[model samples]
Target: MHALDYFNARLEATISPMDYVKAKQMSPEKYFLIDVRNGPTHVRSVTIKDANVIPEQELQSRLNEIPQDKEIIVYCWDVWCNTAAKVAKFLLEHGYKVKELTGGIAAWKEMNFPVTNSDQGNNIPDNCGC
Candidate 1:
């Protein structure tokens, strides 16, 4: 494939943080967001509002909990983290339409996007340390 086509194909399967927000706003039920970070890190950090917390290690067993009807959007701690990619690939192999969240929660937080557990007592660390 040509370089542009290769990159375009790759980009077609991912969603940026802002675009996710817009899509969610436009059609809340069209997408199912999953946070694939480990249990410990996820507990310590605030997650995107309404995103299902499914640790990557437990995903295969919890596959039934994910809705096949909706597009699956997966994210991990940050863009550098590959857990979301692994989960996305797994979901795709099982016939679910999947898109990875570019930059994950790190980018969401960086953009100041809203998250669950945002109470004053909630301590979202600067780094996930995953």
Candidate 2:
């Protein structure tokens, strides 16, 4: 099967980029958007708001840190990145709810979804709704 087919199959046979976006809007706090990109690389791209910054290399030891009850949506910098896929598979193997963000952050940006920088001039206020 093609990689895309494999990804869709892993998504319980019905996953799409738009589905993830819709799920994000349903309950922002319900799902965990786990970013597996390295620190330096992630900083240079469009990062999602409140995404968990856990590098792929450290995920094996850090899996316990994530709440198993919540669904995990793994993502990386771009379509070429496989960190998200690997993380998703690991989470699945561990019996945790998991899904890989198709095309990762690049696709998120392409869809014109919200992106923020933690280091940027406080565009978002501490108490203000984002």
Which candidate has the top score in TM-score? Answer: 1
lDDT of 1 by residue, 29-84 (tens): 89999987764543535878888877777678889999989999999878778888
Q: Can you give the TM-score per candidate against the true fold?
A: 0.85, 0.73
TM-score between candidate 2 and the true structure: 0.73
Candidate 1 lDDT score at position 86: 86
List all candidate RMSDs to the true structure: 4.5, 7.9
Give the per-residue lDDT of model 2 (tens digit) for 1-130: 9999886676672235689778778977778777677545425345777777666766787777799778888887776777677777778889988877877778878888777775532222222110
Off by over 4 Å in 2: 1-15, 39-45, 119-130
Each prediction's number of clashing residue pairs:
0, 0
